[model samples]
Target: MTRLALSALLATLALIGVATPASAHTDLLSSDPANGASVPQRPTRLTLTFTEPVPAESATVTLTGPDGAAWPTGEITADGATLTVPLAGSASPAGPYTVSWTVESLDGDFVDGTFAFTLTAPATQQPPVATTPAPPPAVTSADAAPTTTSPSAGSTATLDAPPTTGTSAPAATSGDGDDGGVPLWVWILVVAVLSVIGIAVGVGLNRRAKRGAEPAE
Candidate 1:
């Protein structure tokens, strides 16, 4: 083979060797209620299946009802292929609910996400339940960032995440304040939306220019 071909083959082989196997420590393969699934009946228990065996320790499942209160339940358990927990029958009212969970792999990798569903809805009126959270590895990576923080050191980002406003936003009418006080986040969102629109317009104009440069067919 030519020297260039030989080098390319070696590089490809190295890349294949460096690729990690697909044995992820843990990931939710499925759920009984299914994330964002709607059902007429309230589930008696919450069942979660993972891609691989996850550790029993430090695993938490939250079933929050439409009332914004925590659903009371027994301790969560990890079976051979699934983690199961009793649903809070007491407060599982007839409305939409969210089940968020945080789990740790035996390797200490963490994952977290939320799914919503509804009870007492008509058979055809079930709200859209997401089959799963956005995705596994992505959610896992987001969860890992919060834990990697060192308590001994200061964390500006942690504190910055919370809203900076000292008071709740008033009705955004003309009478709110002298200059019509607007929330900082609202202004930021407006700027962001404008920026996106501006970029999209620029891209469209550039594409039009490029197309116009082409000769007639």
Candidate 2:
């Protein structure tokens, strides 16, 4: 009877866990091109902002243009909520440029999104680093203008099908469940099952003690 109780308890726990929901870190925010800023030329770098700080080397941001090409020079560099990417050349002929990014939130869940900005005109030259001419005011992209970004033919960011948003859903993982990733339902189920086991053990021991005291047999 005690064993049956334990088994039933375990089964009940599994069902409860299934009924509950799970979520991932969300797509919180960004800060590149201010969402709707106009640029006269393409800048040498692209930057993105997030609600939480991301790892310096763990985040990736891609910039593509209207002609279906990639513009990012290298990997992104992170500092707090900021992630920056350098441009390969100046920028291609302008229109709208798309900046898509994937970042690992402080909670360790990856979230991604794509946003775009319009460029008015070509930049004559890339911006100089801190070493030169007071560094071109830093107001906007001055060198490359009237440019746009689009997905290249073989770019991974390009969607053959439609893109699925990275909402609060938890993605299945391959590691042992303890990736600090036990779901809320998983934890609750574990606790309930343990409690039932404790109760059954207590009741079974009490019944055994009572039976041992029988008068004749």
Candidate 3:
């Protein structure tokens, strides 16, 4: 009976040891921006969520950015099952960012973890500069001189022309402008009307003369 009791006690002790480690250790459930996530903009803060609540003072977080520079952060805070670390300012020279964290759960178990995430390059803005298109290079007297030209003695080409005067005949009208000539179809219609009127007048005169010739008829 003594041996059996001793064996039972040992078995109980083994079970208790196994249960303590399992309950004491906390698991990292998730993180802000997520682990191994590619972020398109600079992240101002980091958040970590665990399977269980962790003590605020026992939590520690460190960050490394591109070029392995240490990123400054504000005081860490804990709320229930989450921990948040705020960056000092906007991150620069975007690239890979690594975060290391350690926390002590409420059960006094110390847990540590590391994760990597990437930051997309920030957009660079180019301010528009007011440029007055370099004032068309000033025209100098030398530049205004006409290029050399040679012509045969009898050439009729002349560059000079008499100045226009108000009395001068008006410039020839373009095809698009009105010219005073009547169209052929209009003139034909006018001639046909005149012919018809002349024929009617002649017929009336003939009738009057015939009646006069026929006497009392």
Best by lDDT: 3
Worst 10-residue lDDT window for candidate 2 reads: 154-163
The global C-alpha lDDT for each of the candidates, from Candidate 1 onward, is 0.75, 0.73, 0.83
Clashes of each: 4, 22, 0
**Model 1 per-residue lDDT tens digits across residues 1-217:** 6999999999998877766444345668899898778787777798888877766667898888777988887788888758898865443458888888888876667887777777874223457887865655545533433333656775534322343477887775554345758857788899999999999999999999999999997
Q: Residues 136-172, candidate 3, lDDT per residue (tens digit)?
A: 7888854454443456654444344345577868787
Candidate 1 weakest lDDT stretch, 10 residues = 155-164
Query: Ranking under lDDT, best-scoring first?
Result: 3, 1, 2
Clashing pairs in 3: none
Q: TM-score of every model?
A: 0.47, 0.43, 0.56
The model with the greater TM-score, 1 or 3, is 3
Error in Å for residue 154 of model 2: 77
Q: Which stretches of candidate 1 lie over 4 Å from their true place?
A: 1-19, 22-25, 121-217
